[model samples]
Target: MTTTHGAHGICLSLLSSLSLSLMAALCSHPALAAETDSAPATRTLIQAGKLFDAHTGKLRSNQTIVIEGEQIVSVGAHQDGKPGDTVIDLSNATVLPGLIDAHTHLTGEPKFGYEELGISTPRAALTGAKNARITLLAGFTSVRDVGAPAYADVALRDAIDAGDVPGPHMIASGAALGITGGHCDNNLQPYEAHAQADGIADGVEGVQKKVREVIKYGASVIKFCATGGVLSKGDDPEASQYTFDEMKALVADAHRLGRKVAAHAHGGDGIILASEAGVDSIEHGSYIDAKGIATLKKNGTYMVPTIYLNTWLLDNADKIGLPEFYLKKEKAVAAVSFKNMSNAIKAGVKIAFGTDAAVYPHGLNARQFAMYVQMGMTPAQAIQSATVNAADLLGWADQTGALDAGKWADIIAVSGDPLADITLLENVQFVMKAGAVYKNNVAK
Candidate 1:
């Protein structure tokens, strides 16, 4: 059975790669192209003056990338081209792979509370549809939405895959699980309100059941609240929500189902406990300590330090209309989160790109790159967090991590060299996903 499955996987990947190559050849036939001169043309070749590869941390100059549909068949000079073949001259701009954000909440808007309560599941899907389009245009070709209400993220992911919506390739966790009155649960009202979240499960049996239910509902990943959160009501950010046994069940079940687990843990004990449970990644880690850092490193667990959300909140909290409790929680957690993240980075734990995008606006996900650079990461290291490392975490390393041959043509360009000034990522001038140009602001 294992051998059969392995063969199946290989065949699937080969088919995906071959389809792009076939499309590129079919789309660029000079004779067929001239015959259909009245029709629109797809890009066949891209000339890049400078390329920043996240894998090598070096900038190469004067390179050619040949795209066959959505995949790059070759990355070296290939002057032989049929007539009417489309060429994109990005010699004036620095090109690289499209950005990936491993952490996002497309369905949930910026504010959460009474306003969030009012939004039904269908409304959440609608919001995801809008946010997904904006995120894609911002040069994030792929994103993993870790949490959403009412399984709305499932609907959104399907819609995007079906071409019913314009968005990044998405891996969606249908709903984030937690205990009663914990971060992922409905804490705004009493149980009498009948507003309990589907994720509010307890004990090993309870969490196991919930994990299976979420997977049954089409969740590509499993997200469980290991610790309390700042945005949620009636929970201290420093407390653990799931016990070790419960977390173990969640992880085991999720892995058995072929899904990775992302633990939303802030407190030190919770991070440590979640690591012990074999959770694939730790989110927030606001109060992570030396012990927690060691545990993460020992387990090879990835840390998704969402440092920018707190900073963005601190800057715009007053305008966002956060409740008083949330304001206090934000202030308390922001500094601790930053300090812990700095410590974790120094500890040398594996890290990935994950901006809690719904906490701020969706399109501004690239802002996290700047914060990563601020936290002791070199410019290339920062870029890798959103490309190579992020893609590895998302299991898309084969398809979309770098601008290499046989990978998806998810490319972006910036006017300035990000190595010289990391802040240039904030302004993505060009975006091409799956061989389709979504935004091109280059000057003629």
Candidate 2:
């Protein structure tokens, strides 16, 4: 009886061990791998209550956006999602195309006198990496980086594209062209500092060469100073900098290379000169007058008014440690910067959204929309300025801007209707660049 019982127990143990081994094999089976490693979702349906149709200036209702990978595949009425598809509920939010800033300096941080000494090209790229994330979180998914030192903008742009860092879809102008002592030059430093800027040159031929050099160094667009600026030392903000012939040469070279030219112009004459010279867009236009507006309209030139910078400077000038010259220029420009943009709108001049971010702060870019509304732009018009208008000016209208089929999935949402209070955009509740959800806080 003992032998029989021992054999029975050994047989039972063997059976149990066999069962465990079978279970292990089952776990390793390809069909059952899902129990240990789940497959990533391939499709997601975003249901929203309101979506802005940027092209038609209308708000869509109860739309379902289907995202497949990095692009929005379809958008229509609610659909019964299939198996393996996920859903994100933004039914309480108002969705819009992700905002675009027509002009920016991703590497430029707010600086004081002589404090600029500490910033090197590598440091500038690092700052750009940091600011790029901040700007992206604030809902500026695309930006045209008009100027940076040492191709810092280009490096940052490439890094973002390679998934090495987070940032906007950047169109970088490696370095801005300028006269020897113009706004884009290193005028603050002494002549003996050996600090002559990279793009500084004189004469029409010199400017043409510099324009070509800027393009060769990875500048997608050409930026030049058409007039003196408020921040540069020893230059009159209202005075013209580049001659018409020089400006003409720069624009011709840039256009010939298939690059648009953005001129930093302030005075009306400078604006007129640049417009006639065939520059594509004029930045600032702080002192642009009626004649300049007409010229812009006639030549189909776009005005990118960074209104909030003047206001920001005026509000914080005392605490900002600006040089006396900057303070004086800021105060003077503050009185009329807002009005110039306002007049441009009234005169039927084309407008594009730009904040000149980093002149005040990065994440505060949405403040420009409110400033635009105050200047008599309807909320739809203001949003269009950031979306369609900006995209058109950047020469990316086919891919971005409107939240339509075949467009890149760069979209954002806010809790309330921005059509009523444009300031709601300042607090973005959701952001999705290229269909990847980076932020979401819409109740559900």
Candidate 3:
């Protein structure tokens, strides 16, 4: 009886060893190994009560957006959440695509005028980290940061991309290319100070080289001063800075390197020159005239009207300690900006939403939507300028203009229909970007 028990135990041990070897062989096979090693895809279900169809500029009721990882798998009528899916219930709010701002300066804010002289590059980057969160929570998931001193915008963008900081998806243009003493230059100090902005370049060759330089330093887009600016010292906003030949060279080099160009043009001649030179967009366009409007339309150039800054600056100039020099330019630009912008809108020129955020404050970007409507755009058109138009301008039309399938899941929600009351956007209650919820006040 003992011998028979020993034989049975040896047979059981051999069988267990054989089973383990067979399992290992199967797992070692190429196809079978991949199947066993792969993890299940993560999914997040969003139940939206009224989803705004950005493509049609209409609302669809009772929608479910299926998200896997960071992409939207599908959007259809309401469906029950599957097991193992994280569900966000925005059933009581109005859901829309996340907003975009074409012109922003995240690295710095209006520091009560000349106090900006004391801000160093590292300090600017730290300030950007704070403003990035504020801007993201305000429902602007993406922004085109037009210019930052010393490549601070590039560093900020990299930090955000690495998940080291919370911020919007940034299309950063390092230091804006400018001619000597132009709006993009540092003109505050005397000649003895040897103050020069990194973007300062001289003639056509110099401008082209500067374009390449900024792009090499991680500029996704090239921004050049086509005209002077209101905030800068010792330059008239209406004066043309970069000549047409130089502008053409700058745009050519930027486009060759696969980077779009934005021209800071607030004068009629500057706008025309920039449009004819093939720039993608014109920032400010404060002094755009009939000829300039025709040129922009003919070239299909977008005009980013940052009209809201005028009101904000005028109202807060004293509080901000804005120097009389800058204040005078602001008043001059503000005087004619509204009429020209309204005319351009009425003439059916292409428009993209840009608030010039740092000129006033971050997180107040939505306040510009109401101003767009007042400037002759319908509420739907105004919203589309930020979504469709801005996306097209940024060359991200396929990635995130709307909440479509196979797109990044960037979405925002307000309490009511923004079409009925555009001002509702100013108080976004829920915000989501790339399938992650950054702000969700609507959820109880």
Candidate 4:
């Protein structure tokens, strides 16, 4: 679990070069050969039919993006080209900044039912790698992996970053912090059986210790179960798990360490407590009331309503192989997710894009876009939640979310305009992350 950070150094460097070559081959057109030769030595021009400017929410027409190495040198009307550049002609497709998922567990674990009968850290890591590739191909170039057992997500994040695996740029939380018997604790069998999860901490002092421990072990963000969750057994989803004092302690400790806190809260009391505690974002505010929403709004807390998980869970419950108690819990929560999220959105609460991805399947993260639109957000606004809003919440507004000069060259292309039909986002035809192309639909 505690491996060296630079283990895959050689592999990642080679993968980076391969990523560039793949894009060059895919975007090169015979007719554009002269333009390519005249371009900069390491520039790639992307001809976009329609581009979603996440910064302005305005779709520009007939745009060409200039990329040099892992940064966007310029994006707009064509500047003159230098020699030996690559040109990708997506003149038939609509282009948008790569999508971001704020809450995702890249490492696989049964969301409901089984609890943790036969799972292992290595198995979870492999599953995470697979899911990461699927998610990247789906157009999510960046994701914040919230939690996994034994810091598995940290390994996955490094793997993807090192090019040992193809996946989204990740901000890994390492593990979620929970009080003993709280939602994130591995409360599989009775307490007499075994205390397995490192996440379980108790009281203000304990939570503060846990926060420091996780950060020391390489957690980029900190997560806590402020309330009971739908998948955990024996806890009422409406019950607040941690006291306000405990939450305040956790948030203050994480923030003082320069880390943001994501609170997993369902009940109204917990949501309000987390908001008031200065957590950066609240996850799954299923039982939020008007007062809770107001508190979140007034405090500038972002809500990551994972609306799609309920539908996916109900539709594929049998495949999940959960224990009977967990299954019942999923059934109970599934019935109310839509209404809960819709009301939250209608209330004008600040929303960031998050999908409880492991609860459903991983690659299908983009499916949440249409659900967001159905929940009263315009397509443009929904797209922004996954882009600009998510970036801002992650404190990466300067680097990743939008397509602009001096930002990472993370971009994706689709066959149609997502602004007109948000469903088009579900099928990302081309994917490029940090100037490397992992998927190209236009390639022969």
Candidate 5:
């Protein structure tokens, strides 16, 4: 009877094993089976001699990046290259995270003397497409277009995202909100002229209405003119346009709708007011003083000092058809911008790299890096301002601005280390965005 029991137990064990196998097979039905059988294959492997780690501001040597579809699957020393994977050997170059431009006007160029002859929406959109391609080739894989005439920038951003056109990833603010006769307003007209720019909102109610309108038009960010601007006619650059209350209202409304506010502020009062009102970043803090610097630091507000614009404008003023009045303003503001930015850096204010690119030329955006370095920022810190810090300001930290596992494969390579000579970044030899290589000097 004991022998019979032992045999019966063995039979039960075998039956149990068989049942388990059947259950496993059922769980691995065709759909599940296909998933297991068809793991995603690596599409590309970037073999880099040196890779810039934007997170730590360090250079990692002899790295390989494995990519799958649009994202980086893995990045390390022993990254396995799969069969049929296209390999880009950048062993002779220094690979880094693709550059980011914090300020760009993709849709419009600065009008020189002919204020009425500004490019139409359709024409501006076409120019934007061209500029986008040039910018991508120059190695800026992402940009935060701070302002555009009307809502042209919004359409361009959508077009690039939808794959209808080739361009960098864009975080666009459709149109800058402003009070009547303020910097963002089309105040170039004579007193008798009736035309006004769309963003000319007055008082708290007017500004609030304009902010909502821009948000409805698909602005990922809200831009407002907190002070008079050099480019705008008949406004004092040092005078604050929007009152503190007005700015606070705008910031509150934008933040409530899950959007960050970018204030175009050039004066001390405007910068301080915007900072105190909790704006995300201040653009062109050209006239920022000690109090403004303290306010920015205390509030943790970022300063996007477009230092290059002043110099570029002064140099190319005539060629770009700058009006006599605007030229005078540029000359007056240029020196102040450099000094104010230098002081802001010394005062420990948060800096985000931004070049008012449309004010100069699109492809020369990287020249701003040198200016940042000159302003007491280290080369590494300057690059970081453009990459990690700018990404944080744009709310795109999780997606781009770093070379890491699971980030979008937006990267570029130069012949030499940018850390050694930051100017090398001004001429990128290779460009890749979303796992697709758009420029490669070696392959060419």
Candidate 6:
């Protein structure tokens, strides 16, 4: 009787092993594995109380936006979502297209004088990760990172794209092209150090080669310092750094490669030169004169006037630890920036919003909108500068700029009507990028 019982237990164990083997084989089949691994499609419905028509710079009431995956499927009048759809109720808020910043240096924040000497390339990349989140949460869902050391912005962009970190959609440039001892160069060190900047290139041939190199190394846009800057040591902001021939070569090479060029031009001469050379956008047009404005209009060049930093810098200069040289330059630029920018805006030279964020702070990007309104721009025009004009400059108008059906689902909301009070955008209540909600105080 005992022998019979042992044999029966062995038989039962063998049967169980055979069943498990069969199940494993079936599960390993390609079709079955795909079925098991695939997740259900996500459908999100956003009920907007008042949707800003970014395309037309108007407002439409009682709208709904449907998102599938990372793109907008449809956006129209209110409709009930089907079953299994995630619904976000922003019926009490005003929804608009996500804001864009045409100029940014995400790899570094506010730093002063000699303190910038110690921060290395790796550290800058880490700083970029932090600032990217802050910028995105502040409702800037797309940014063009104009410069960073060692191409760190490219790595940061890649990490964000791979889902390893959260950041706004980024268009990163390589090291900004400049002449030796220019603003883009490391001009602080003495003759012994031979501290050549990553972007230091002289002559037309040198700059054209530099442009190709940066593009080869993953630069989507080419940024070149066309004039001296306030922050760099031993340079005059009113002086042009790149000659017209070199600027022409740089612009030609960048355009040939299908990348836009941004020229950091503060002086009137530099602005006119850059505009005449066919640069896509002019940054920091603090000294723009009548001729420069005419050149910009003639070339259809966009002006990314980073005008808000003037107020923030003057208000917080002590905390920022600017040296006497930088402080003096800042004061000089600040004194004239508003008048020049206001004149340009009044003259109808296209303006796009940018706030040299690291020079002030990252999250305060929206402050520039108020400054734009102060500069004689209507609220709608100012908003369009950040949205439509910026997208056009970045060459991403089809993918962003407006809440259209085929665009990425980049959306934001404010508690009040921004047309009535543009400052309301400073405190964004809801933020969504690529169908993902980063901040939604309305739901909370």
Which candidate number would show the highest lDDT if scored against the true structure? 3
Over all chains combined, what TM-score does candidate 5 have?
0.90
- Model 2: CA > 4 A from native: 1-41
Best by TM-score: 3
Alpha carbon deviation, residue 224, candidate 4 (Å): 0.5
Instruction: Report the lDDT tens digits of candidate 3 across residue range 88-202.
Output: 9999999999999999999989874568789999999999999999999999999999999899999999999999999989999999999899899888888999999999998
lDDT of 6 by residue, 168-282 (tens): 9999997999999999999777899888888889999999899999988999999999999999999999999999999999999999989999999999999999999999999
**Candidate 3 local lDDT, residue 170:** 94
Model 1 lDDT per residue over 238-276, tens place: 999898888998899999989999999999999999999
Q: Which stretches of candidate 5 lie over 4 Å from their true place?
A: 1-40, 78-80
lDDT of 4 by residue, 1-444 (tens): 543347597677778889999878856866577675675356898888888999788898988899988999888964444567788888889888899999999897445545565778998899999999899999999898888988989999888888899999999998798877778877777768876577888889999999999998889999888998877767877888899999999999999999999999988899999999999999988888888988988999999999888787777777766667766877776677678778889888889999989887888998899999998999999999999999999999999899989989999999977888889898889999999999999532
TM-score of each: 0.89, 0.90, 0.93, 0.88, 0.90, 0.91
Compared with the true structure, what per-residue lDDT tens digits does model 5 show for residues 322-405? 888788888888878898889999888888878888887788999888889998988889889988998899999999889988
Q: Any residue pairs clashing in model 3, and if so which?
A: none
Off by over 4 Å in 1: 1-43, 78-80
Worst 10-residue stretch by lDDT in candidate 5?
A: 110-119
State each model's CA lDDT, in order.
0.88, 0.88, 0.92, 0.87, 0.87, 0.92
lDDT head-to-head 2 vs 5, winner? 2
Residue 220 error for model 2, in Å? 1.0
Is 1 or 5 the stronger prediction by TM-score? 5
Candidate 4 Cα RMSD after full superposition onto the native fold (Å): 10.9
